[model samples]
Target: MSDNFSRPQHTAPLTPILQLVNSAPIVLVAFFAIGLSWWFLLIGVIFLVVGGFGYWASWQRRFFWLNEEGELEARSGILFRRSRQLRISRLQSVDILRPPVARLLGYSSLKIEVAGSGDSRVILSYLSVGKAQELRSEILALAKDERTSTQSAEPADHWKWQVPNGRLVASLVLTTSTYFLIIGAVASVAFALVEPGSGLVTLALAVGGSTISLIAGITSLFNFSVGRNDRGIAISHGLFTTAHYTVSPIRIQAICVVQPIAWRPFGWYQVAINVAGADQSSKKSGPRVLIPVVHEDALPELFHELLPSWNLEIEDEWLASAATSRWRFPWQAARLAVSLTSDLFVVRSGALTRRLSAAPHERIQSIRITQGPWERKLGISSLHADSVPGPVRLRGRGLASSVAVHTALAELDRMFTARKSRKSEQW
Candidate 1:
């Protein structure tokens, strides 16, 4: 594990330009808030340019390279100097994000996302795309106890998924999130124009914020790609701001496969996972998307690729919408479905947005069963297998009978006990 390879010395040369491009929206908002006149804004723009360059110049002084102890180190600051070091083995995720403009400028930003403290990320901006990719491969290799990727056209022995443009657009449109923003934006405009009151204007201003979400959703959906190899699972997407995120699949704790109301008809599903070191604060913000959208036909192989142990073929009966239990919990528990395979337990529920949650047995920390008065009277209950936080929740409501629920729980306990006995064989 010698640090023999030549590594990147500093941030890309166009760091200032990339920073300015990313900061433009914030700068504009600040100007609008301050009621800056056109001439004043012009002056502010000049200052912004100068300040961006100054920040970049100061930032680049922090050289990034392998230190003697085999750690990624950075030395920075102009007036009050600062230095930081991150253990190569402790790195959680390495990402390359390229805004459209940055790509045109032949530059991208590298995000080194790690665990523990909130927002503890190391960012290197303006790296040439090739250089960024190279650095990422090298760092990831060192961290994962492997060699860097070959210079071949593609990685060998891997599962790669390409999301078609049509599917991406369809998923984005069909996604409730996209329309929620659009509706908010439309309502904001309507209010601002139709009712000219200060209070209404404030509300409109609040709703106007959805404009950014709409734009982000559109930009985020572009060129989404997912794949898995011996090293880990890799996800790269975005057009306006392309990003490459990689995580070791072994670290994946839970998975949530979602089919929105509109996309359900087409059988389009989005799979999101919670990995060992991922931050779970906001679903939309984090880079936790496993597969943005894929049709049903592709799921068998996709599931195996991402979670091999949990590749439990769910039969149609297991996906049963518990129509008979509709009276118990209305639409909420109407579509309840649950299945347990040797390695994985899956629960599918939700009316408007059909959700399929899967968690490997090794990750299941606890299990519980509950019944309400009416459910008890009906000799039915709900089952829950709780695990660490993320998108995955294993809960099946409206079981057909209490005896069946107990049988399932007993089976779960037996399977878990057997798996524990054969620890090496478990997922």
Candidate 2:
């Protein structure tokens, strides 16, 4: 196969179909408006034709290729040309996504993320399955400074963890949201008996929102699996839109393990990670789920494989919250604890949903000690270790002021030492 990606390449011929499908929602609205006026039907027809033509034009203008400097370059837009360049050195992750429609048509998309680039994700859409896979491998190879053109055989990955379809469905159904949904539903029914008009509206809204949330959760987490390959940790999941993510261990900043009260009986936990360059604010691009659901016993092995460099064990001597902290966090103060290992800083908190957040020493961005008016009166302070935005949050509340200060200084020293050592090692 020719490795001549230097020449600009267009998306698959079927891209217009996918684009049109995406625009169908607008057409649907137009159809609904037809009841208001027959002119709406004519308008809908015109919109569909114009949208289809625009999609074709946009598809024709979009192009991607490798430049002389080895950076991935893309250009798109019809009137105002928009150009993007992705430096291989700053590459964070390369993911393959196949939405329901694209999968049905044997097509896929590549989502390329770069470090330190906010909201600048580059997506190469509507590529043939084979072509997308080949391009993905090529990009990964180039990012690693390996000059190769031929497609390599898939690496033999040792499957580490998998979530059963049954467990996944059950987990989604058993969440706090489900509880709220049930309560709202029952309340709405009661209200309807008292005031029929308002009650019906409340019931409809509650059911509609909860149903959508449940369906989205199920679709996103269905068939979740994690494994280790030659490149890095591989995560695959989704029902309608399957996504395969390749995350390098070095890019991981922090890890969080959460166990909801309801899931405690089953000894199930959910693990999420904070990775560099991932959009933390957006739900659609938040922390990557390392494992949607897993038994507690499997955690040691999972951590060992995912974070080979860090010591995963929690130390027995943990810094507990101050006695006076009960004034602020009555129920949770007893559960608040923080610990530091040779290689990791760990924080534990939460009552109903127990959370364990850990970050490697080198990954800690900053250390802060905070004391509010109430905390000051109670002689308590909070310590926080900042990291890249994600699910893993390193914070220990309700610590003795003296203890918080000492721990913060110690952590700063450890962070510097870890960073210095890391700099000495070659990638």
Candidate 3:
């Protein structure tokens, strides 16, 4: 019964029917269907009308109002008329989502995440593009103001890692190539088993499938974007439902940078962080946002701006003193080896890109050390690391064979203990 409508920080006008009609896929599908039957055309017309009204209704129900009182109000659900109220202080992270059509319509959706148990959250769709920007700016200002008021000294810049374009290209090529190969292999096998009479049909189907895969890969390029500014990082990506994530440094629990095998050639890597209440995916999924590609050089700057608390020493000068014995190692690696290693250890050092040292630790969920028969004979071993966020094994991608299995266990111990200690301190 609250009749007083508070002032909204921003508002988005509902997208119209003309905007939906402009979509290429919908237009193409509707055109093709109409050509097949008058009945189809009738159904299409009805759909367009009903769908437009529904879009408007959904828009009306999904508006938001952020007042000067440091509170956020979201109105949603057409029939149920549900609304949520929350203090801005409790907000965890604010995510902006824009679908392909939403992009064309120049609008985005907003999700206000808060720290609480169960399904306590607020989401508003159809926020005008301008309003989304304003809201982001406002939130950043408020968060900064609050922090500045509380503390006199600011944290130093430490973490500086962003996805590189080269890595993105490499990832795209690898993904597309694998998909095409898989499709071709499967189609060839199927055709070989089929009768000769349908040879032409099978060939056509194969070509069509390959073309779709190529298109999908091309579409993925739009998913590429950037993350910047002081409030935190904002990543924009997706083919259908374009996702935008805005994370603040205060909420970050851990930040991890990973380089997978496929991207090793291009020196491409991914950066993700374990954040508090921000990892929206299931418990099995990795941390919040995945910057699928990034240059190694930029990581230092990005880290400094985003996570000042890490105090990461990423310079080659510092690395020089860390030591390498046919294998590179960090100060933490020595501790890992001491605590985790049962007997043998593996230490691998790279002149440029990768350096690893691993050891076994107590109460390990899974520990694996792998080596080829040649390595086995030579008494060399490779160490593997795994946890709830998934495994990170440094064995492959060109490390030496002389590294013993014992080295790996120690490295594992070092890595886990450091992380656990850091986590405990944060608490």
* Clash count list over all predictions: 1, 0, 45
What lDDT is reached at residue 210 by model 1? 47
Report lDDT (Cα) of residue 192, candidate 1: 65
Q: Give the least accurate 10-residue stretch of model 3, judged by summed lDDT.
A: 314-323
Predicted model with the maximum TM-score: 2
* Cα lDDT computed for each candidate against the true fold: 0.71, 0.82, 0.51
Taking all chains together, the TM-score of candidate 2 against the true structure is 0.88
Give me the overall lDDT of model 1: 0.71
Judging by lDDT, tell me the better candidate of 2 and 3: 2
**Tens digit of per-residue lDDT, candidate 1, span 62-156:** 67886766567776788878777777766777888776778887888788765657646677777888878777777776666523433333233
- Minimal lDDT window, size 10, model 1: 146-155
The CA lDDT at 392 in model 3 is 28
The lDDT ranking, best first, is 2, 1, 3
| Residue pairs that clash (backbone atoms under 3 angstroms), model 2 | none
For each candidate, what TM-score against the reference? 0.77, 0.88, 0.58
Q: How many pairs in model 1 have backbone atoms within 3 A of each other, for residues 3 or more apart or on separate chains, i.e. clashes?
A: 1
Every model's Cα RMSD, please? 5.5, 3.3, 8.8
